[model samples]
Target: MFTRKQFVSASVGALVAGTLGACSSNGSNGGSAATKASDDSYTLVQSGKILGASDLQYPPLSQMNESTGQPEGFEIDLLAALAEKMGLESGWIDPIKFDAIIPLIQQGGKADVGLSAFTITDERLKQVDFTDSYLDSNQGLVVKKELTDDAEAYLNQAGRKVAAQSGTTGESWAKENLPNAELVPLDDAIQAMTGVSTGLYDGCVADLPVVSNLTLNSYTDLTVAKQIPTGEQYGIAVSKDNPGLTKALNKALTEIQGDGTLDELKTKWFGSNI
Candidate 1:
């Protein structure tokens, strides 16, 4: 899981909209034979492409490259590889609101799959099916330098304002674990981190990897105060209407894991940190 500070500007959004419009047009006319699957065991929103939906606001996991107006990250690479393994084109990745992805997939005819860093939980299983676990992660707390080092004590302090990304596990964890603390839900992790950096919030909660990345690379003034090991596992979500697709994804994931491809990817992205 990860989050970046930049959002799609109006011009960038227009560019993306134009690109997707072209994709839709070409998809109707068989853009590429590679995207067309000879076998009909599974369904796809687009015939010749695996349509993937992601927020594209998360870094390392997924983020938009402003220069190309396209997404690039570990999850994007993995999804491309998965598409290749399934005998489809590189795949059409559409940037969407993170929380809207699940609902769109469940409603059908939008995307073939959701490739964000979605943690597998019992509550989510009721809405959509998930493939085998890919990444294991946990929640983390980030705060300014002056806060007490004792995370528990800091959280217990009255009137402490904490921030978390809306609709994320971090938000839920903060609400449950720091009931007395004021909870501020923001659109993305960057906003939460910004809140902490500007003293708008006492601290912020987010995925451990995200907090670490932001602190190390972008928000140097901030630090990871504590790590909350929630034992979260990320997975690819498939529509409940497409069990066959889920099975196919699991098979591909197993093959990749067994062949060391997954390890190579982890090493490439996480380096010595893994």
Candidate 2:
């Protein structure tokens, strides 16, 4: 008989072939980051735990819980589920810089994985390995409420300032699509939205799901003027050195897809499955 790992890993890639329209998530508070390093089934950075590096500011995917003072979001819950399947607990690098997440995973000793809604790109694949995509994403054009007249065209004009998180696909999209507009690279995705809300920028580009949630709830002053399909997919980042860990996560991810847990989580957080 094939091992569960063998069965799951074998069909992993086939499981999430087509991307789904990612929806916003509302997550439960997560465990705190730990310092201990030891393990069993796999040589994890920490014993009985999966240590992750992430920027805990992007809502629906990852963010800090105001009430609990801990990380909370879809990615956090997803990581927790993956860890449970591997008989490990989940913890993370609280409030790390978005661009620095991959580097910390590459350096080792700091984190075993990165789960900050990272897009699976050819360039990022060279630096770190990615698990099967969990969600399909697109870029959103977010503009201030006052920019009611043709927000997209208005922001597309020359000298119009646009904000996007540095080192992200949204920034790349702005560079390519909004070439006439000035691109301001912010340190965090929320900062870009805040800048737009406060009139510091005419607009910003970020993940559509995040923009949808924020515009509908947090930043009602902003609006999603456009959903730019970039064919981007989000993945859990694993180190090249940790093949066992990668294999373990892939197996767990496959199980989640097969057993309806993924659908359940999607509904719980996003209000429906994609």
Candidate 3:
């Protein structure tokens, strides 16, 4: 039997193959970002318990840090802001794989919503509904600084070994754009960068901020080579059946952006008003 890790790496790629589209634009709130879908004509469930889940990897958005040894990143802060707006007390479950979040909601109704930095894609849309975009995340490739000039050449190469966080949009982008390349999925950006450092993978594909975080501090040797037109957007996800949950969250998300609360949080964490 394939282990969960191997199965996730192998089958999930096949499961999501060839079904990505341009990500939606960020919301006015600047606190959250998502696809610009026609608003769901559903009602927010008055039931009070809202569950939040995120993969405990990928820094500046969601990752473990040396200074805190706990999960602290942009997404967590953003979600906290979202929760404050809704007056909803959220119950957080950690270490869930990105792919499993939708299923957990669909099957168990385990979470009222998901709070990970999940990208919006049509393939995922079939499984769960998404709120308006809260962030704009362009796709990018990170490699050793020396290979900056050879990025386009590398993308054109066959079997280029690229690393990504398991079940992330980065992994999905690699499957769509570089199908011929060997996509090596790690658990987090730290490991992804480590793979590049150890010569285990030629490069990594991830959101611009993740690549930025990697290069800005620890991974000095790594640099972003090419920016792919992923037009990626991140949003909160809920079961399509939960129209009520979706509506309330979307409203809350919108208010955050409209009132500049989102911008405040963005500046606090990111240093530039997003």
- Candidate with maximal lDDT: 2
The prediction achieving the highest TM-score against the true structure is: 2
Better of 2 and 3 by TM-score: 2
Whole-model alpha-carbon lDDT for candidate 3: 0.69
lDDT for model 2 comes to 0.77
Which residue pairs clash within candidate 3?
A: 29-257, 32-134, 33-133, 33-134, 33-135, 34-132, 34-133, 34-134, 43-244, 44-244
What pairs collide in candidate 2?
A: 38-47
Candidate 3, 1-274: lDDT as tens digits? 2221332344346446744342222122112123322233222222333557777676778776668766677877777777666654545665787678878766533455676778888887888888899888787788888889877567546767888888777887788877777888876677888888778889988788777777887789888888777788898888776554577677888888899988887776666774
- Give the TM-score of each candidate: 0.82, 0.83, 0.76
| lDDT of the candidates, in the order given | 0.75, 0.77, 0.69
Ten-residue stretch with the least lDDT total in model 2: 23-32
Considering lDDT, which of the candidate structures 1 and 2 is the better prediction for this target? Answer: 2
Q: Candidate 2 residues 188-271, lDDT tens each?
A: 889999998988998999988788878987899899988898989998888776655677788899988899888888776666
Question: Candidate 3: TM-score?
Answer: 0.76
